[model samples]
Target: MPAFVLLIAALALAFLLSRLLRLLAQFRRIQRIPVSTVALLPGSGQAAVTGNASGAQLSSPFAAIPCVFWSIEVQEYRSNGRSGSWRTVLARTSDAPLVLDDGTGRVQIEPAGAALFLQDRFAAQQGMFGGLNQSTLDALERLGVRTRTWLSTSRRLRIRERQIRHGERVFALGEIARAGAQAALASTPDAPLLLSNRDAPALARDLTMRMLGLLALPLLLLLAALLIGVFG
Candidate 1:
């Protein structure tokens, strides 16, 4: 049993390493991307831009707050009726196109599968068996909650959502192109697009911190293995 546990632990550690390496690769690409104004990017190839996010300012279907892009998670505090854990009731993201304007020009962004880093625009936790808000109700309708209507009063619902608010400064690194009169940002197979709310320096700082952790991870894992072997 101990050996099995050790093997499982080793596999888990390897999975973590794999994920960290992938993130490191992504952040490396982010660091290499040179930030430019929306006007300076070319019609093709790798391009990066910094600008204010704007578009059809629609309310986030889940959060009901206005923004360019949004992601949301609805969870319920579920338990054995005593002690409990949060269970994800549903999760969704907005696919609406966003525009990035940097004084000189505007570029439309297609956000699917792109690395997006934005701040939370709305978060709330109602008390035990609290009332569901309008946002939650709308989300339920959109998610087809007919069979799950019990969700309304059965659990302690909590909502968490993030969005790139209207006029919020953002960074974009992606494939730039001209679609007729409009410029656009998209991800090519070779170069993935990255969208972030932070400026270049702030993003670089975040990358540096994550890279440091990734760099030290292997050594830490090795040390942990050795310690376990000795103490087991």
Candidate 2:
């Protein structure tokens, strides 16, 4: 019975440790972003449609919007003698069809999606899990949220760039075009990217929290085992 208890405790400890590590990582990631920005991303379809309605309608008639789609693009720079070519990253279903420039024969990506994709692509490419310890990996596995792949693929573009103007801050068209090519790919279906203009930080935070929960499994089990020991 004591041996059995130890086995149970070990399993529990493994689970909890995994959860805690995942949450901590997520928290640290979220803390890096500005909260105000996440607020600006579009909400649920119903909320988006009714945002301009009467004040009474705006109170609490609808469910909160959950993240649906989020993507990032990145550019890679390589040298081919004196000339260079730019490739689009983060292709999605929603993005405009790519067209070859007649004069330059270069591929062009819509600016907005391109920028967002690049930020995420760069982040992923840099290896977010480079220094993660074994405990963290165990936690991620427990949560079933491991990074499967992050490569570029030839697919329809899903994110389109939209220009936003705010006073003197002018994002030039050519400026955004500099980010090389989008190469980082994401996991699908079970791990669909959560999209929200302002919620990246929140999403990162939630991921961290969820990881922590997984890590705590061991502690919870240990408590249960202690109780069983006293009772048995």
Against the unseen true structure, what C-alpha lDDT does each candidate score? 0.76, 0.32
lDDT of 1 by residue, 142-218 (tens): 77543133555444667778888899999888887665689898888766678889987777778778768766886
Where does model 1 exceed 4 Å of error? 1-3, 75-89, 126-138, 144-153, 156-158, 211-232
**Which 10-residue window in model 1 sums to the lowest lDDT?**
145-154
lDDT of 2 by residue, 1-232 (tens): 5899779767866766765664564345335432221123222110100011001111110111121222323333333899754455433323322222212122222323332311221122223223334443343335343423446432111122221111111111111122244211122322222222333444455565566566566568678879988997
Candidate 2 segments exceeding 4 Å error: 1-12, 33-198, 208-212
Candidate 1 — which pairs collide?
none
- Measured on C-alpha atoms, candidate 1 has an lDDT of 0.76
Candidate 2, run of 10 with poorest lDDT: 46-55
